[model samples]
Target: MNATDFIVSRNDLQQCKSIETQPPEAAALPADALLVKVTRFAFTANNITYAVMGDALKYWQLFPAPKDFGNIPVWGFGEVIASKHPNVAVGETLFGYFPMATHLVIEAADVTKRGLRDGAAHRQVAAPVYNAYARVSGDPAFTGKQGDYQALLRPLFMLSFLVDDFLAENDFYGARRVMLSSASSKTAYGLAHLLHRRDGIKVIGLTSAPNVAFVKSLGCYDEVVTYDAVTSLPADSPVAYVDMAGNSDLRERLHRHFGGQMKYSGRVGLTHRSTSPEEPELPGAKPSWFFAPDHIRKRAREWGPGGVDMRFGAAWAGFAPKLDQWLTVTEGRGPAAVQQVYLDTLNGRVPPDQGHILAL
Candidate 1:
């Protein structure tokens, strides 16, 4: 391909416009630099967060934006077409952070440092949480040698695993029923799957009716409840809640229903709202923010190398098969479809039962 194609975000429709082809040249940098061709990127909640939160996050101060137009941060698998670095060579595949753009050029120096690089290095950085690069692994966790679609899902699985860890670490002493808001969302479904089989935990999934049957098909919850039907729940179930919906009203209802028994409330995502307002008066059961980057970092330090290896590595292996079964892939990465996908996602128009893949 002589020209690289990409989707550029435009304010016109709060949408992305496709740049079908662009002139491609030999390494734009020194000989040691590597040219990476983006393969597939999942339009994930985290990336959406980067777009929506934009310049507002407190941590955004760490990574200054290069331009005013909101940055489109993406994570996906790619192939190295050329490389001057010995560690990475032509034809090698890797997984890492990339912009929504088609072709990316990185110096060997930047490639090697990856996660360690600060905002000063990779300008226009949004989240300090993600590493710049992830070397594709032959480990069994990534579907053997090819990685395939499975590699794209590693980040989602890792977040679910870490959420599980957070519950465990907090001791969950008084925790009883667990309410999963945004029950139709992929992340919520996965978390519910991981916890459903546990001996005593009761899983309650709160979603819309369109998603009710689909979520129930997953069979990972003790009960699937719709947001409108939440009034049917026991007024005092003494529950712990996971708020993925980011709907303040639902958050309030969960707090009120469980009241004092609401032992723990975790806020993991704001999928429902493009941008959520700050809660001046948080509800009865205060929602604790579960930032995956922070959780992983703390665990890495506390568990050391061996601890991380045992927990995350083991979690990845165990969860891989189940994840693959549910993560259905969609084809093509044209920008025209991307805006529709986002719109559907925003209005809860996308089918809750399936996962999405935007092949670039």
Candidate 2:
């Protein structure tokens, strides 16, 4: 049998690098680690952030890999084919940031450190400490119910909860309405939904004209406006702009339109591009980036694990149902199809709110 298995790769920027032609010996699993045979992975905005931001995010390039290798894009799910760790055994299916390859040997320590989610019903163990993990549901098919789809919202909800907690505790410096770009995206939608639950704050969602209705369909925002409708927004609106679209021009336009009213601006993502440094801060507003780990670390120290966990649990439970409607799945491992999907996502040609599941 041929040893090579197709692996999607990118060289630099958004270009499709090419299929790596190599033998199984070249991608060998460590003797002491479990080897996951990858079967599927979902393309979320979070992975897009990693692909695009690269070395910009803190501790991104700081971690030491099994070998002295360059940075690897960490996200995906798979099944275990081999294992030396007692906790992980042969034939156990797992999901986490395994890799975007046919098979990957993940150290047991890395699994424990990074987190993995498997379910008993699915003949696996679910360790969601690093990120929420769920049972793949009792029914084989997507049942469209909350329990049936908890995995869809777990990661996204954690981010949304973290964002809400940050804004609630921090001093916005006198900002009222929160301007959320990528309003149609799942992450942004999660934020908009959570913030809308309580009164007194306004959620202004910004997206393209095509997604305007879909964004409004979420029914969580006080106002839904298109990107081109920037000028139409209230000038000097005294608002906080939460940027989700990493487009420099849009960030500049939002800053210019709202000006001093844009009291606080947080750079959360560059979902539009697969390779670009974090956007330069907009002048005038208090600018910084939002990272879930940093926020969780600080809060965990101050509030302790119990308090933070309880709060986060409630937030996750609240947004659980809404997430199901936002996911889209695609099958096949055709080189051309995967290439097109990657290019489309990088170019912002894909719909902002829809999630993509890639079947390998």
Candidate 3:
């Protein structure tokens, strides 16, 4: 059968195309292999971060593409149409990392009641989180609108959960206030929600003027300020900066404005992709990249087996319900709609309150 894939240029994310190719025949499946038919996936600014940091984070390595193009990884659901693996059935559904294509073939390993890992040789070196797939039938989070919310915000919220844990684990780096840039983004606001519940630490959201009302509506941030009004924030108080926008100019401005008062700076996303790659020497804490998988591994060692999952699940139970009131899910199908949504997300045209689920 012909598989359609949407690929983007490695050098220019704006340059993308949908191409048709042949997938492996179901009858000729290798031992312990499963052919998953891609159904739908969520696309957000976070996916754009995967593209922007594809090389640095090895995202491009997950799915092979042409020499100059890449198949961006996304979190979504798929059905096992054909399986040579004895433990996995043909009709089972899965939730995990997938390419922007119609199908995927995974060499299933570590089969269990919960899920299995894609033990394909090429994917061995990628982060373990991206390599794992969960069985939808056994997952409690698969019911109701949970699947859509999971597709849209679970991954981002995981990062938010980790960031909040990381900060609290360090006693907020001796800061009384925590500031988040790109405050309107899902990840940022998710972090804000967690931090807002904490005592003594005020959550401040730095956003664009147009998004001030939306950010304020979340009721998670203590103070919402526009980019131009960043100087209005008191520089005397110790603060931790969690950056989601990755705007170099804004980074420099905040660093200069806060100077020694900037206790910790964690870079998480690149919602603004045109920023400079070189970060000049600044006065405040040096900007550091926050890789969620690294933190997950760290927590696993400190918390023992399934401890992270237990804590995350509890947090998600409380947080997931709030999203229904905050997000409006919009569905898109086929190549044209997918391409348009991709472009809209890439150009920052999608609203912060809307979640996009697309099928190719």
Please report the candidate that would top lDDT against the real structure.
3
Say which prediction, candidate 1 or candidate 2, comes out ahead on lDDT. 1
Query: How many backbone clashes does every candidate have?
Result: 1, 2, 0
Instruction: Point out where model 2 deviates above 4 Å.
Output: 1-11, 17-31, 58-74, 110-153, 274-283, 306-309, 334-336
* lDDT of each residue in 43-113, candidate 1, tens digit only: 65545555555445532333233233333656666677876676676776667666665666665545552
Writing each residue's lDDT as its tens digit, candidate 2 over 1-360 gives 121132223235444433343324423655456656666655566666765554454223322222222223434456667666666657665555544456654545533432443221211221234333222323332233332233345566778888877887764456668889888877788899888975678899988888998888888999988888887987755788788877678878878777777788887877765324465556667567886778877878899857887887788767765655655544446446555666676567777655555543
lDDT of 3: 0.93
lDDT of each structure?
0.64, 0.61, 0.93
TM-score of each: 0.83, 0.78, 0.98
**Of the pair 1 and 2, which is ahead by TM-score?**
1
Sort by lDDT, best first. 3, 1, 2
Better TM-score candidate (2, 3): 3
Scored against the true structure, residue 117 in model 1 reaches a CA lDDT of 22
The 10-residue segment of model 2 with minimum total lDDT is: 118-127
